[model samples]
Target: MNITDLKIKAAQIRIDLMTMITAAQAGHTGGSLSNTDILTALYYRVMKHNPTNSKDENRDRFIASKGHSVESLWCILADLGYFPKEELTTFSQFGTRLIGHPNNKVSGIEMNTGALGHGLAISVGMALAGKRGGKTYKVYCLMGDGEQTEGSIWEAAMAGAHYKLGNLIGIIDLNGLQISGKTSDVLSSEPLDEKWRAFGWHVIEIDGNDIEQLISTFDMIDHKSDKPTLILAKTTKGKGVSFAENQISWHHIVPTVEQLNLATIELRQQIEALRKEEN
Candidate 1:
């Protein structure tokens, strides 16, 4: 898909995310909204995978280390037909596999995530496995800035570099906020570029919410380097929704009916604008 197509698709994904969260009556709304564009561009335009053949060994693997935002992943996976769209309404309900966080049972989910610091560690293992097995598949891990404070993340970073896992790509959703407060106030992960570079990973920073920037950045992945890649995707906490943008309160609130209506209208306007541009 073209950049314009991915932009439109991302807008619709936000709409679906809102609907899913509103229906569930609870979710990590801010993080989910913040990460939507990254997920959309990957699933729709970058990743090499087939929903019908999800278990294909040669396919790329995507792991959401910051799994609180599984709502975005769920919406994308369902839309891609990895699972039925009807199952989305069951999110957060009892006995539903589509709970607040991802589980391996979910059709397209590569691993069960939600223990904030575990995802990157797991991705390192998968990437190493690919290396050992002589597989051509790449492994991508989505992490949050807040999750960076975890010692395990740095440990995995060192491991990836040690192994020279060039096929492993780590993308951090640098949304500037986490659940408690601003990430800087909570735990500063500053000097990010130098930190990752020193750990032996190639780093690139860009606006995560810009579909065109995302497409081009993905194309710039360098597999020839002996180092892994890290993308610092600077993004807004709650993107797309007007009132929710960068608002900490929306981090986990179920939007009131009025708020949902307002968000829906705002997102609809954006979608329409994109549609007109397409025409």
Candidate 2:
């Protein structure tokens, strides 16, 4: 898909995830909205993934380290035919595989995440194994900014660089706010670029919500280099929705009936505008 098409797809994804969260009455709303564009760009354009063969060894691997914000991932996987879209309604419900976090039982999910700090470590292992096996696949791990506070993340960061796993790509959804409040206030991981650089990884910063920037940055990465790459994707907490954008409470709140209707209308407008631009 072109840039315009990708934007439209992202807007639709926002709508889909919002509806899912509202229906389920549970989700990491702000984080999911913040990372929708990043996920869209990866799944639709950058990553080498196959819905028909979820276990294709050659396909790239994606780990959601900040896994609570999985509503968007679930919606995207379903849309891509990893599972039936109708199953989305069962999300977070009793006896459903589509729980609040990433479940490996689900066809497209690589790991069971949501522990906050273990994703990067697991990704490091996967990348190292792929390197040793002479596999060409890349491991992309998406982590939340709040998750950077965990000592384990830094440990994985050091290992990723120590092994010089160029195929290991880490993306932080630096949406500023977490469930508590702004990340800076919660536990600042400021000077994030310098910190990653100190860890011996190549660092790149970009607008996380911008599909164009996300795609271009991924394209420009040298996955074969001697250093791992970290993308500091800066974004608003609750993107796309007027009332929710940058609001901390939206981190884990389910949209009220009125809020859901308003958000849907706003996102549909964006979708329509992008569709017209596509034409």
Q: What is the lDDT of every predicted structure here?
A: 0.91, 0.95
Q: Per-residue lDDT of 1-279 in model 2, one digit per residue for the tens? A: 999988888888999999999998988899999999999999999999999999999999999999999999999999999999999999999999999999999999999999999999999999999999999999999999989999999999999999999999999999889888888998898899999999999999999999999999999999889999999999988899989998999999999889999999999998888877777
lDDT of 1 by residue, 30-143 (tens): 999999999998999889999999999999999999998999999999999999999999999999999888899877889999898899889999999998998999899999
List the candidate 2 regions with Cα displacement exceeding 4 Å: none
For model 1 the local lDDT of residue 71 reads 91
| Model 1 lDDT-worst window of ten | 2-11
Give lDDT: candidate 1, residue 179. 87
Instruction: In model 2, state the lDDT of residue 77.
Output: 100
Off by over 4 Å in 1: none
